[model samples]
Target: MLLITNVTAVTVDSQRRIITDAAIAVKGGRIADIGKAADLAPRHPDAELLEGHGMLALPGLIDAHAHSDQALLRGAADDLSWRPYLQEVIWPLLSRRTQEDAQISLRLCMLEMIKSGTTCFVDSIVPSHYDFDALAQAVQEMGMRGVLAKYVLPDALFGRGESPVDTGGFSGEDESLADAERGIGVWHGAAGGRLQVWLGPLVPREEPPASASPGFYRRVSRLAARHGTGITVHFAGTIDDPPFFQREFGMLPAEFARRYDLLGPNVLLINGTWFSEEEIPILAETDTRLVHSPSANMKMGEGFAKVPQMRNAGVTVALGCDAAANNNCHDMIREMKAASLLHNVVMMDPTTLTAEDALEMATIEGARAIGRRDQLGSLEVGKQADMILVDLKQPHTMPIHDPIANLVYAAHGGDVDTVIVAGQVLMQGRQVLVADEAAILEEAQERGLALLKRAGIEVAPAWPME
Candidate 1:
């Protein structure tokens, strides 16, 4: 048992209340209690105590929509548009990635995420069989909580302007269910259920006739429901996405999902950037959760998500960093900033999104995204003790008028001093406890460059060092 005391705890509850001079007790990886430091100290006298003076404890940030495997190509594909970059560069590179590459990327992303104050994430890796073992091992080694799902497509999904068939010249339909079952069996409930298993279907609409039957998605949805796991899919990103679904399926993305019984308790829609006002009601009426990536969406010229509108419509909104290849960084701080600004600007109301709302998207709402709200979202008593200690003494964060506002607007990843996940410290004083940062960085750079070269792509010349 561990007792973390003497910190200002930002509970991030509905009232956006902050408890000063407070402490949280952790037992068996769950937050045992939280209250005023003086009041709670006597209750857990024998527990391992962690003093949190000069720090502000917040619920560990969550990344709802990230491609953990893209960590290897973090800065490599920046300054490019979405389509050409993913089609010409990223997709080709993904085809050649080995299990070794996946493991390295997973580790690299996990380390970066922890440093950025993200305790948990939902990764969308390329559709491949090797990721099952690679990511399972990588998550265990890294000590991060996440839902690792294989990126599945009925056919070759992204290299061409139009979707391509699998390499075998036949459809890759069976691959989806196979990978789903394989991932759930091995990784679900691992790490005492801190790590979740999920299914990610790459295609937003129905599969090709040669690839799968209409019942294929039904079976996939049913399987996810049966196992009580979450399903994440990139439903709509641009103006074209909804129309594309409409043309093929004769229904909007949300309508289509509902018609096929896909809208349920365990489904998350990534990047609902193009959702129309009409569709908002349907989404809110269903159990589907929405994961919004403002940085990536804006970078791709996708307009800001209707977050304020969605929230007003009673929709659950979660934040994601998306792929580093697109956003170019796995920084939840930057995402929070963008989310706050975008909503305020779009709504023409500065108070449209409070700092507390932005923080919830990164923490509690994100946990709700992957259906882990019961355990991993907040810093409340009886919740999992996944939290971060932010250095409030930093220059930018000093003179803190409002702790929540300072956190959303000023504090960056560098301000994160300690990160605790499930009662275990994964990082302290910016030092990762589970892996060597130098080794991981070196391996990712070399492997990523090698893969980029093999795909016949050239990069910008390195800058001269002083």
Candidate 2:
């Protein structure tokens, strides 16, 4: 049993309540009790106590969409638009990764995520030579909740129209499906139920030949449904995606998905920036979720998603930092701030999106995006104890008139002082406890250089370097 007392609890509950001088009791990986600090101290006299003076306790942040394999490629694709970056940099670099390289990258990603107060993330491993079992083991050892998926793409579409320029290493549909099944067999429900496996297919923008057919989607969807799992796909992020669908299939991406029975509560659509006004209702009607990567979308010059419209239409919108290579970091707090400001600027209405809205997207709505709302997300009684303590004593956080506003606008990921998941403390006072930080950083630096050299790719510095 663990008890945290003397803190301001920002319980993103039904009423969005905030309790001053509060206490939370955790036992058996669940929140047992929460009340005034003075009242709960005597009740849990024997429990291990943690003093949380000048701290704000809130639900741990969640990243609904991420690419763990891109950790090593940070800063390598700067200033390039989405299509060019995919064709010129990312796909070529992905072809050169080995199992060891991938393990190193995963470690770095997990390390960054933990230090940034992210207790849960939904990640897709790009198709490469990495060992899925090894990646799952690393995630388990780190003691963080994760939704892992194998990147499934049809071989016929690989290296073809609208895809990357170089896609020599991708697997065919049959092979990719087999690999996804193997991943499900090995990692789903592993780590004492902290890890889940999902099927991730790349929704091709261009019309695939009739020989390719809809059989690929039908097979994967049936398998996913049978296993009681979900499917995530990239949709309408680029200008090409929606236009391609309209020109080739005579409908929008959402309609195309609806034609194949792919839109539902279990489906998560990533980066729906190009979704037309008409598609918003379809997503709301089908109960499909959307994950907005504000930083990545803006960095790639892709137009912003109609987040305000989507949220108003009854669609759940969540936040994500897409990948280290694209966004250059995985800071959910930064993403939250970006999300709040981006839509406001795009709509030319300062009142379009609020600080509370951004925070909810990173918390409860993010849980719904990954289908874990009942167990994770909010800091509620009988819920899993996944939360973080943000130090409010920092200079940037001074004069805090509103806690949610301060959190979403002023604070950085470094403001997180403690992180707990499943009633276990993974980080305290900004120090990680589950892994060797020094060694992991050293190994990542060493492996990253070797990977760049092996891939024969050089990233020119924007400024002068020795």
Candidate 3:
């Protein structure tokens, strides 16, 4: 048993409550209890104690949608438009990568994720030889939890009549399903039940005519319902995308998905930045969740996702970094800040997104987006012991008037001093204990340089440079 006491715990419950001078008891990798420190001190006398002075505890952050394998190409495609980057560069580079690269990429990404406030993530699938088992193995070694998706693209149609023939990498639906099955069998329940398996339709709405399977979505829904797992697919992010459904099927993108019975609890709509107002009500009524990636959407020139409207309409909104090449970083705090800023600009009201709401999206809603809300979202009793302690003594964090406000508006990953997952200490003082930080950084830099050369591009200066 372990007891973390003397911390100001912001239990992000339905009330958005905060408990001062609190202590949390962890037993058997689960939060045993949480209450006033003085009351619980004598109850758990034998448990190991962790002094949490000058700390603010909150539920572990979750990255609902992430391309974990893209960590290798961190800076390779900055300043490039999304279409050319995806077609002319990323896909080609992806075809040449190996399983080893995928695992190493996941390791590096998970480390970065941990350094940020993300204790959990949903890792999207990649094309080039996805060794799901090896990927899970690497993430587990970091004491992080994730839902590993085995992405199956029945055909490579990116909508708008673009087919796999354009890319020269097409596989049958059955073959892709077989690959998913193999991945599920290998790592679905591995890592002491810390990992979950989910079905990934790489781009459900994007398939060429010859390769497109009209009934493919129904099959995916059936599989997920049968297995009691989640189904994730990219939707409504590309402007060029919706026209395909309009021309070919005479329906909008969201309408097309709805007509095929693709909206519900099991379906997670990834990157719904292009969703129309008409689609918002459908998502709300059908109980569909969304993965909102602000930085990537902006970088790709995708317009703002109607975040305030989506939240108002009862859509479960979660934050993600998308991928390193697209967003250039896996920092959830930056994502959080982006989310708040974007909503304020779009809504023309600084109060549109509150600090508390931003924190909720990063924690509870994010966990729900990937279907892990019951176990990993909040710091409540009976949930897995996953939370981060942010040091309040940092100069930027000094004179903190409101904990949640500072966390949302000003606090960064560097302020996080401790991370606990499943009652295990993964990092202390921002130093990861289970992984080699220096070596991982070294390899990541080497791989990134190689990726830039292969993609035939020079790295652009960091975000605000000329």
Number of the predicted model whose TM-score against the real structure is largest? 2
lDDT of 1 by residue, 1-466 (tens): 8888889999876566689999989998888898898889898889888888759999999998889777777666766665677767777777777778878888888888999899888886545545476677778778888888755554434334445323322245575567668778877889877777887775563333333234666777877888888788777766767877777778787787788766766888887778888888988889678889999887777676788889889888999999888897888988999899988888889999988889888988888777877877777778888999999788888898898889999988888989999888999878898899999999988899888888787777487656
Q: After superposition, how far is residue 407 of candidate 3 from its true place, in Å?
A: 0.4
What TM-score does candidate 2 get on C-alpha atoms?
0.95
The digit string of per-residue lDDT tens for model 3 on 18-132 reads: 9999999999889999989998999999989988985999998998889987889877777677677777667766765666667778888988888887888887664526566
Shift of residue 458 alpha carbon in model 3, Å: 4.1
Could you arrange the candidates by lDDT from highest to lowest? 2, 3, 1
lDDT of every predicted structure (CA atoms): 0.79, 0.86, 0.80
lDDT per residue as tens, model 2, 1-466: 8999889998888898999999999999999999899999999999999889869999999999899888999988889987778767887787777889889898899899899889999885455347778888989999999988777766666444554432325446677788888888888899878999998876656633322235677777887888888888888878878877787778888898888776888888898999999999999999999999999998888888999999999999999999999998999999999999999998899888999999999999999998989988898999999999999788899888898899989998989999999998999999999999999999999888888888788977778989
TM-score of decoy 3: 0.93
Cα deviation of 14 in candidate 2 (Å)?
0.9
> What value does the lDDT take at residue 249 in candidate 1?
72
lDDT of 3: 0.80
Which runs of model 1 end up more than 4 angstroms from their true locations? 155-171, 205-214, 461-466
Using TM-score, rank the candidates from best to worst. Answer: 2, 3, 1
TM per prediction: 0.93, 0.95, 0.93
Best by lDDT: 2
Prediction-by-prediction clash tally: 0, 0, 3
Candidate 3 off by > 4 Å: 155-171, 205-212, 454-466
